[model samples]
Target: MMKESLCEVNNLGLRYHRGESAILQGLSLSLFKGEIVGIRGENGAGKSSLLKAIAGLLPYQEGEIRMPKEVRKGLSYLPQDLSLYDSLTALENLIFYGKIQGIPGRLLKTRGNWLLEELGLSQKSREKLSALSGGMKRRVHLASALMLRPSILLLDEPTVGCDEESYHRIRDLLLKMKQQGTGMLLISHGRGELEDLADRILTLEQGKLREKCISSD
Candidate 1:
């Protein structure tokens, strides 16, 4: 069966400043429905830059990102840096994000509560984000990203700083999302995590990308 293309990056190019080294050059990739694509690279290899460009956070100097208008409405991006507000409670943060997404107040409340419970933050729903541990904060971030039940997720190290149980919960959630046909572009330093979750993995180096062989051992 042919896979449906959710997003396409064609010959993308980016640089922080003119005359400086290019961060990404002539990179092309496609994400398909229900697929998990893993990106691996050393520091400064522009892994995060690529995701940022795709998410419309960073503007690429060359090439283009193509997606259907409807798909754009369902896209979600989770950066490596925490994007949540420290002063807001977990539920409040979700409501804030959900509202921005235009979710109705009644529906947003229901959705926020559901996500907090699913990510194991139900007990801490009213706790301020700053009062939570790193793992808890990460979970809340995930919950906020999930508020819209996004069809495409650009996740940058989604499990970083997570406790063992929280890590497993997230892994299971990703699998479930995949089963539900959510396409994901995931970046992780752990090779085993990529091998287990990604249908295929791509390595980024020298501002380019190449398909990598997965070890069976």
Candidate 2:
């Protein structure tokens, strides 16, 4: 069966300032429903910039990105930096983000509870975000992103600071989401991580991207 395409980027080019070197150029990629595409690159590579462009956070000077209305409406971006308030509890943060997404109060409550339990953070749901460890905080941020049950998920280093258990839990959750038909673009520096989670892996270098050849062994 042919997979449905959720988004497409054609010949994308980006630069923060005029006359500066392009952070990304001539990049083209397509994401299919229920597919996980992994991007690997060094620190200075334009991986994050590519994601931001797709998320509509950055303005690109060249090329075009096509996302249908349904896909755009259901898109979610989880940046490398956690975007939760340290002053709010984990549950409170979820509620806050849900409201911002215009989710109904009752539905938000139900969804938030389920996400907390799924992430093994139900016990810490009411704990202030400032008190949570780095891994716990990352989980909370992830839960907030999942609040929308997005059709397209852009994850930037979702397991960067995660411990062994946390990493496994997240990996499992991502696979579950994939099974549920969520197309994802994940950014990571770890080749093993991508090999384990992504159906296709692409490496970004010098503002360009190429497919990574995996060993059959």
Tell me the lDDT of model 1 at 212. Answer: 71
Which residue pairs show backbone clashes in model 2?
Answer: none
Q: After superposition, how far is residue 57 of candidate 1 from its true place, in Å?
A: 1.4
* Candidate 1 lDDT by residue in tens digits, 1-217: 7889999999999999999989999999999998899999999999999999988899889999999988899999998889899999999999999998888888998999988877788899999999999988888888889888888999999988788888877887888888899999999986478988888799999999998756452
- Measure candidate 2: CA RMSD: 1.8
Model 1, residue 77: C-alpha shift (Å): 0.8
Scored by CA lDDT, what does every candidate get? 0.89, 0.91
Residue 12 miss distance in model 1 (angstroms): 0.9
Instruction: Tell me the tens digit of each residue's lDDT in model 2 across 93-187.
Output: 99999999888898988999898888898899889999998988888888889999999999999988888778877888888899999999999
Cand. 1 Cα-lDDT: 0.89
